[model samples]
Target chain A: MTLYFMTFILFCIGMYALVVKKNLVKKIIGLVIIENAVNLFLILVGFRFDAEAPILEEGMGKMVAFVDPLPQAMILTSIVIGLGVVALLVAIAIRIYEKYGTFDISQIRELRG
Target chain B: MIELHIILFFMILAALIAVEMRGLLNSVIALGAVGMGLVLQFLLLRAPDLAIVQLVVEILILILLIRATVKLDRPSESTLKENWAYVLCLLLFAGVFLWFGYRALEGLPLFGAPEMNVSDYYISNAMEQTGAANIVTSILLDFRAYDTLGEVTVLFTSIVGAIAVLRKIGRKQ
Candidate 1:
């Protein structure tokens, strides 16, 4: 409920910045927001109230009171992927600044083709 | 019933506000919030895959922004008649989108809910084909390997692009 709306709002906001903003940084921010909103949405979708972490105890035959473990694993993978993207993006940004002499995306108007 | 929608309304308002704000960094931060929110939604819907992708993309994007902004300065809040006019046009655009949204939800998502219950289908027979406890992986990589291949290609393209971009810089330096 509250979570769903928040996620959507985040997505729309990111889209807006990506579309409307001329600053490269702002647009990047917009991209980040979009990514976060989607991640949050995914997490929220799988949540179950009062469910414990999916941990199996010794001599416990698949205890029934456990939250799904898949999401947690997915989150870990997502975090790793995010790190990779961030590193690549940062490298790109550094190069763009050196070449363009500015971070204002509107001014990086060399690409007309 | 109405609680979720009401919250969504507020969130939309916030998103619009962030977009309208002139501060580039602030807008980007707002965008991060949006990404986090998406992950939450993915979790709620039991879709961890989507959430993970979102998180990874967000991190990369944020780094790109910060790096890109190292030499850039924020634009001044200069008022212009055309800008306001454009803003008005955007408002109109939002109105159109709202109408479309309403229309979309009218019969959406579950055009034929009973017949297309993917969860049920996966649960009942996924083990037979892939023998993995995680049905999603089997569906994504085995039952639907094409989609997975597409995803891998997209990532591959990005990695290659990044490498090319970096190599050009090395040559210039």
Candidate 2:
């Protein structure tokens, strides 16, 4: 339970950075941190104490317990998604810097209407 | 459990340093440390698959971030003040989220409990159904194949988009 709360706190810290930071790269870092926190939370939620990895070995006896594999699969997908998003974000940031000549969010107000 | 907590503490500390650091290179390195901590936590949680994926992804992200920021000038200090209004708003949001999150968590099973019906089915029958020893691979490739397909598509689209954007930069130069 404490671990869960700590993960949430980490997530909130990421949220603070994402919402308040001015640098585009810092915001991207925050976004990745939040993604990781949530992934960690999900993996933690599915953990089983004293459980073995979710693999069935040949000639093994009937298993009474194995760690949950569903969340692992889901998190795999999510991690890949995060990778794609981060790559794209960095690309966009590079282009933005090329155009605006700065990485500050406040100064890139051309879209503000 | 104590070990887990220690790892979490370091993870959070790394995140804080990453967010507060002035140099982009140092910040990126801090974030990579946080990712390493997370990979360790995943291993401690009995998720070797996740740990492997996280390790590779973290390396990839670190490379991308360093490549993107290497030639760029150091970012100017932000002028946005950390005022009371920001703190109050963040506190309110955190309070509401933690309250509701705790409430929701209470209704669910505790850590390390086999309480999820769907997961139970998958764990019990995956080997027999798919003839795959690794339950995670079976779940990803056999049971939830459509989702995997969609994820691949998403990845491909992002790669194309990144190439296009970077190509534009080259053309402009």
Candidate 3:
């Protein structure tokens, strides 16, 4: 229960950064933070006390305890997706910097508008 | 549980530093620390596959962000003071979200005892059905192969978009 709340708070911190920060790179950092927070929460949902990794050993008994594998699989895909999004975002940021000559979104806003 | 608690605390702290720090370079390094803490948390939580992927992805992201920061960042660039009105509005929204989110979270199964109606089937029969020792791999590559394909498409599309966006010239214009 507490852990879940902590995860929520972590997400809120990310939201805070995304909303409050004026720097483009800071906003991207916030975005990644939010992603990591959600990923942690998903894996946390599947965690089991005293459970081993989900891999099956050659002679392991059927009754052996293993953590849930579903969220792990989902997180694998999410991690890769996150990499792509971050790459694209940074690329965009670089271009913005090249055009506006600043990483501050406020300056870019005033310049463009 | 205690170990998870410590790592979670570490992650939150690092994330806070990453967001609130003044130096862009320092903030990026703090974000890297946050990712490392996440990798540790994943391993502690028995998600070896995620840990490995996360570690690799974190390295790539750090390299990319550092390159952007070093080459493009100007020392004169400083964060502007955010409008207090906007900050207050955002706080109000976040408060409402947390109140409702807490209620929604109350109905979920407890932390360590998830409702595994679907995963139960996957765990038991995945090995024999897919001939894979790792249930996660089996599920990723077998039961949900279509999802994997979509994921690949997304990756490819994003990479292509990034490459196109970063190109020096577009259509000779």
lDDT of 3 by residue, B1-173 (tens): 88888888988999999988877888899999999999999989999999999999999999989988977666676546888987898899889988888998989998898888889999999987999999999999999988899999999999999999999775454
- Candidate 1 local lDDT, residue B79: 21
Better of 1 and 2 by DockQ: 2
- Against the correct fold, how does model 3 do in TM-score? 0.97
User: Residues A4-104, candidate 1, lDDT per residue (tens digit)?
Assistant: 54565566666666666665555555665565556555445545555533333346444333333444445544455555565567567767767776655
- Scored against the native two-chain complex, candidate 1 gets a DockQ of 0.24
Give the per-residue lDDT digits (tens) of candidate 2, residues A1-113. 88888899899989988887878888999999999899999889888888888888888777668888999999999999999999999999998988887787777885443
* Model 2 residue pairs with clashes: none
Model 1: runs farther than 4 Å from truth? A1-12, A31-96, A105-113, B1-23, B48-57, B70-82, B109-115, B168-173
Cα error, residue B82 of model 2, in Å, equals 4.9
Highest lDDT among the candidates is held by which one? 3
Better of 2 and 3 by lDDT: 3
- Clash count, predicted structure 3: 0
Model 3 CA lDDT for position B4 = 85
Question: Each predicted complex: what DockQ?
Answer: 0.24, 0.73, 0.84
* Order of the predicted models by DockQ, top scorer first: 3, 2, 1
